[model samples]
Target: MNALTGVLRYLGNYAISSVWRLGYGARLFLLTLLYSGESFKRFQLVLKELYSIGVLSLVIIMVSGLFVGFVLGLQGYNTLEKYGSEQALGILVALSLVRELGPVVTALLFAGRAGTAITAEIGLMKATEQLSAMEMMAVEPVARVVAPRFWAGVISMPLLAALFSTMGVFGGYIVGVVLIGVDEGSFWSQMQSSVDFHEDILNGVIKSFVFAVAVTAIALLEGYDSKPTAEGVSRATTRTVVTSSLMVLFLDFILTSLMFTS
Candidate 1:
């Protein structure tokens, strides 16, 4: 009976802690939103962060997209060839990338690369008392620091996802038509006929945008709330990657269900 009571007490405390964290994260998100308008005045900062988060991330996004599409093309051709549907390779690759893999993989990569960087940078600022010093000077750190990075992540995500899909298509074409002798005309025509711009492509963009907000929010919040120490900064960076990845996957399911359900 005592062990049962202890187990119940532990579960209750865990639930309460989880709720408290959620509420606190929501509060930070709201505060960041409140100061986001200030980013307009600091346009150069936003541009710089855009370059950092978006431009710097391009190489990995493209390379990964290409290779992933290449593999899909190869595997897809093998499977479809067995079923006498090899000409549908283009549609297969296009729908796979645009509808699912593109946004999902890009966001995962973004979280690992840009998300961790955001957390580390902000946590380092906190460790050095930069945010506190800004407060002393009557400056809002959220406006000056967090807001630009947040908005940068938001703006960069969809673009990166698009590029990933485009590259994936190209890679698929190279493998399917150029190498495997699938009819180029059929590949392109079938893909064009099957992929709906509004439904498949637009919904993918929406998914990326939603993932952007969730990832950026978690990254910035973890940094801002981190303990002002090296260990704390490291932990926050790790947490940023883990939490953002999980959030991206979870949000992807919810968005996919809503987008596809009748």
Candidate 2:
């Protein structure tokens, strides 16, 4: 009963606090735009995060994205061939990569890598009383710990999204041209012509930014609330990854619906 009550209370606190923080973040964003200096630190942090989140993770995303695209092309071609629309393989690959698979797969990949790292790192810090030490030193934890990660996510997600889209297309090209015997030039041409780049790319990029924020926020919150014990830190780390990943998936659904509706 105590554990159940604690769980319910945590959920309640999370809901209220999340709503409040979202509003606070929005206000700060607007206020920062009003003052050039307020945004500069975030900008620098963003660049660092881009290196960490986008450049550092490049190889994994490329390898996974390449295979995903290849499989998409192969599977799509097989499916469309039965319906006598084998030529539409280009369109199918482009659509899937842009609309759905790109963000979800990329976010999942990111969560497993950086997401867990952020959680474990923060949890360890908290468990070791380092955060308390910072407090004693008059350092603001939010500015020191949270803002950089949040801004980093916002900055890096779009770059990663672009990576996913471009690499996925390349993967599709390989399968379409080499294995499936389609002309390389024609496959590229068809892909270019079939999709609305502005719609697909912009929507995905925006979604990536949002996913970045979601993942970072959840990770930070888990870290902040982690217990002082090793078990507590471990549990917080696990919960951070699981919760962040699930939230990313859910947010993707809402984002896709909103993007496609208009």
Model 1 lDDT per residue over 183-221, tens place: 999999999999999999999999999999999999999
Give the lDDT of residue 9 in candidate 1: 100
Which portions of model 1 miss their true places by more than 4 Å? 1-9
**What TM-score goes with each of the models?**
0.96, 0.82
Report each candidate's C-alpha RMSD, comma-separated, in the order given.
1.3, 4.3
* Sliding window of 10 residues with minimal summed lDDT for model 1: 33-42
Score candidate 2 by TM-score against the native. Answer: 0.82
Q: Write the per-residue lDDT of candidate 2 for residues 141-208, one digit (tens) a residue.
A: 55666566666665666677678877888888888778888766666677778788678867777788
Best by TM-score: 1
Candidate 1: C-alpha RMSD after superposition: 1.3
Clashes of each: 0, 0
Model 2 backbone overlap count: 0
